[model samples]
Target: MRKNGSNGGRAKYQCAKCGYHGYLQPAAPAARYAQVEKLLAERNSQRSIVRATGVSRMTVANLAKKSAISQPTAAAPAAEISPAQALGST
Candidate 1:
């Protein structure tokens, strides 16, 4: 049992054990969610995104898939060589 105050007292929660006092604040759901969306847009790696986003990487992947955003594909490498070969024949 403890008294909590804004000044400098412990926040109190009842312990499941033999009756003890504990103090900690749970995270707000919305704040945690916004972090996730931001990270996905940044194209961060899954593990790094999890650390920064405060959400599971799997969630980020799902959002990315659902986002339906298309990225430009790299230029073809083989086509360049073929064009040079075409010019040499003439």
Candidate 2:
């Protein structure tokens, strides 16, 4: 197969023998993506995630941004008051 440029960031290949053309499969598998996500969820730094997962820094950063946007913000916990405060004694 010969290189036929890229489409949507994926490399396209053309078969020299049979005239077949197709995009190359992703280099990283789904499990690798999951592992990256897991590391991100654990609050690991993007650089650390890249080093640990062997994924590119850009990939980790993109995933982190995507995850950040998708997840909803958590509400802060309500503060507790002492019985005396509640009774307005102080």
Candidate 3:
């Protein structure tokens, strides 16, 4: 399955199993945001989280903001009024 290029450069390769082509670039740094978020939730400092997770401080901050935005928060429940207050006796 080896064939030389028409330009006389290096030969081209085609995979029969996966059909993958060209160079595959590495993923972005935010890929480890889960770990970063875990560390952030541990009350670790930004610098400490960066040091432990090897993620840039800026990226960590951005991911933290994104996580916060995605989370759903529950509203506080209303307090029960006393019977005296209800009867206007207070």
- The lDDT values for all models are 0.66, 0.90, 0.72
Candidate 3 lands at a TM-score of 0.50
Give the clash count for each candidate: 0, 0, 0
User: How do the predictions measure up, each by TM-score?
Assistant: 0.42, 0.53, 0.50
RMSD of 3: 9.0
Pick by lDDT: which candidate is best?
2
Give the per-residue lDDT of model 1 (tens digit) for 1-90. Answer: 334333356466655655665577758867876676677677767688778757777777776676546645677676445766778974
Which segments of model 2 are wrong by more than 4 Å? 1-28, 76-90
Q: Predictions ranked by lDDT, top down?
A: 2, 3, 1
Error of 2 at 52 (Å): 0.9
lDDT of 3 by residue, 1-90 (tens): 333243345455555566644433346655677788888778788888888877778988887788778878887888999999999995
Query: Model 1 Cα RMSD, Å?
Result: 8.7
lDDT of 2 by residue, 1-90 (tens): 999999788889999999899987755667898999999999999999988878989989998999999999998988999999999997
Which candidate comes out best when scored by TM-score?
2
lDDT at position 35, candidate 2: 96
